[model samples]
Target: MADIDFGDAPAWVAVVLAGGAFVISLLARRDSKKSAGAAVEAVTEARRASDAGVRSAVAAEESLALQRQEAAARQATEAEAARPRASLALHWQGGQIFHLVNEGTAPAENLQLLTVSDDAEPLEPFTRLGVGEVAEFLIMTSLASGAPTALEFAWDGQEDPVRLRVPRSG
Candidate 1:
C-alpha cells in the first residue's frame, strides 16, 4: 500500500469542473440552434398548406359557378324548344286583294281576323292555317271611308291578338 498526499487537489478539481461545464454549454447551444431551425421549417410548411387550401377553395367556387351557368343555359334551351312559334303576315297583291299567310313552324288553329271598327264583322277563312299556307281576302277600299292601316288576328291557344301592318298599294 502506498500513501500519497496532494496539496493542490482542490484547484485541479475546480479546473476540471470548469472545462466540463464549458463543453456542456457548447452542446446545449448546438441543440438550441437545431431546435430553432426545426421550428422555422414547421412554420414554412404550415404556410404552404394554408395557401394550397385557399387555392382549392377558389377552384371549387369557380367550378360551382360554371355548373350553375350550364344549368341556366340548359333551362333556356328547354324553354325555347317547348314554346309554340306561330306567326302571321298580311300582304297586298294589287286590286284591293290581300293575302293572309302563316309563316311559322306550328299551325294556327281557329284563325279569325279582327278590325278596329267595333261594328265590323270578324272574317274567318280557315279553321286551321297550316304552316306556309296562304288565304286570300278582298278589301273594298273604295266603299270604306278609311282603309285599314293594320289588321289584328287571333287563334286558339293564343294569349293575345297579333297585329300585322298592311302593305301600302304602290
Candidate 2:
C-alpha cells in the first residue's frame, strides 16, 4: 500500500463519523425501548378484553335461567287455574235436619248423597246447587248408630265421590 497523507483533515472526518454513529445508536436504543413498552401495553389491553368477554357470557347465562324459571311458574299457575274444584260441606242445624252448603266458586250439578248403612233412607238428589246456597235434608238414623259417621256424595263434573265426616249430635 502506498502511504498518502490528507493533511490532518482525515483525523477530523473520522472523529465526526464516530460521533454520528454514537448519536444513531442512542436514537435506535430509545426507539427500541418505546416499542417494548407498546408491546406490554397491548398485552395488558388484550387480557382486559378477555376478562370482559367472560363476564358478559356469565351474565347472559344468568338471564336465561331467570327467564326459564319465570316461564315454568307461569305454566304452573295456568294449570292450577284450569283444574276443577268442588267444595261441599255438611252442617247439622238441629235434631234430624242437616244442610249441605255449596261453598265453592263453581256450581254443583246433580248433587247426590250416598248412604253407607241400609237403615238410612236416601235423600232426594239436587238438580243444581249454586254458590253459597244450601240444601236441607232429614237424616232418619237410629239413635244407637247416631248419624252416619261419614257421608259420601257425588256431583256432576266430579269423577270420584267426596266423603265428608258428619259431626256428632250433642
Q: What is the C-alpha local distance difference test score of each model?
A: 0.86, 0.85
Q: Report the number of the highest-lDDT candidate.
A: 1
lDDT of 1 at 65: 100
Model 1 residue pairs with clashes: none
Runs of candidate 1 with Cα error greater than 4 angstroms are: 1-59, 74-84, 121-126, 142-144, 156-160
RMSD of 2: 5.3
TM-scores of the candidates are 0.60, 0.57
Query: How well is each residue in 21-127 modelled by candidate 1, as lDDT tens digits?
Result: 99999999999999999999999999999999999999999999999999999999999888777789888998789998989888999988876578688775469
143 in model 1: Cα distance from truth in Å?
5.1
Candidate 1 lDDT at 97 equals: 92
Q: Model 2: how far is 117 from its true place, Å? A: 6.5
Strongest candidate by TM-score: 1
